[model samples]
Target: MGGTWMQVLGLNWLVLSVTGSAATMGVVVMLQSLPVLLLGSWGGALADRLPAKPMLIAFQVLRALLAVVLLAGDSTWLIYAVALLSGVVGSFEGPVLGRFGSALVPKESLGSALALGSVLSSAGRIGGMALGGILVGITGPSALFAINAVSYLAVIGALSLMRTAEMRYLPTAAPADRGVAAGLRYVRSQPVVLIVLALSFVLGSLGRNYQVSMAAMVSGPLPAAPRRTASSPRSSP
Candidate 1:
């Protein structure tokens, strides 16, 4: 997941560097997020019904495959499509990993376990971003994507080594059984939850476009000229 974020930043920077177009970067970023926004809940339901370990493995493989495909693809549309699909797969992977976290630790210690998990995740994100910037500076974004693909393989291997004997998939309770129209309807039935959901939607719709706003600002009202260095001259007697 950290690797995915690294790949995303590297890819965006690389594409923008090559195209010199902020609009393209915005489109790429939006495409990368669209699937998670659209399909994340469905992904969570699917995760509940499926085995977490295998689901994670499949998602990682899908991400790796997309990375390899992007390596071979030059078209922006191809990259966009791959990125969107990766997000969808990643949505499923997110909840699956969360469930796996529970299985990996004791029930009473779950809170501490999850806290440590989050700390490590944040560390990975920061480290991966720094490493990605260096990698992009030296080799290019495609190379970073390739490295991310391999990192996904390492994750798959780690998941495989985990014990799964007691880690059975918890059967999803049917919506009908819960006396709710659907998950959304159930959520909406609670006033606090409904308000939170509405606020989240509003924020996501407006706030998530900050990248576009930044790009526009940089290109429009606050354009900065590229810096150039002058050569030094020496005098001889």
Candidate 2:
């Protein structure tokens, strides 16, 4: 997750650097999320059909490969394409990892494991952003993308080292309770889920989407007082 965040921050900086256009940067960001909006349900369904361990390993590898692609060029089109591909990978990776982690512990310990995952997630985001900011300043966004690629390899290694005997696998979803339509129906039936989804949508759209603009400002017309900001003197006015 930290690596994911690092790549996220790095990609925005990369696009902004190459194009010098916040609107272009914004389009790349939007392309990443467009896949989630369009195929997220299908991703979750795919997760259910595949073995979580190998699926996660494959997802991690695919993400790593995408990061490597980002490292290869600064072409605006290449950046946009890789961003979209990363989003497609993440769409399935999110659900597969969630279910895979759940199976790692007994029902009694599941909540604690989830809480720990959440903690790691928060920590990863914070650390990744901070580190990415520093590294992108020092070595440029290409290095940052390389770091993320290696980080995914570490995840693949750890997943390989896990013990299959210890996992507490749950029964499969019934045929009647499967697919995108059924999932939507379940979400509609659960008021709490509906509310959470509504809030998430609102927060993502209104709050989180500002990163490109913020990055643009920090790296552009609204450059920071310090030289160590996302925009170097050479890149900024």
Q: Who wins the TM-score comparison?
A: 2
Report the lDDT tens digits of candidate 1 across residue range 1-237: 578767866666545544545677677777777787777777767666677778778877888898888788556667677767877776777777777777776677789988988898889888887888677767867888888888887888998998898664344677463332366676867899988888998998888776556555655577631111232111111
Report RMSD (Å) for each prediction in the order shown: 8.2, 3.9
| Cα lDDT, model 1, residue 233 | 18
TM-score for each of the candidates: 0.79, 0.88
The CA lDDT at 25 in model 2 is 72
Prediction 1 TM-score vs. true: 0.79
Among all windows of 10 consecutive residues in model 2, the one with the lowest summed lDDT is 228-237
lDDT, candidates in the order shown: 0.70, 0.80
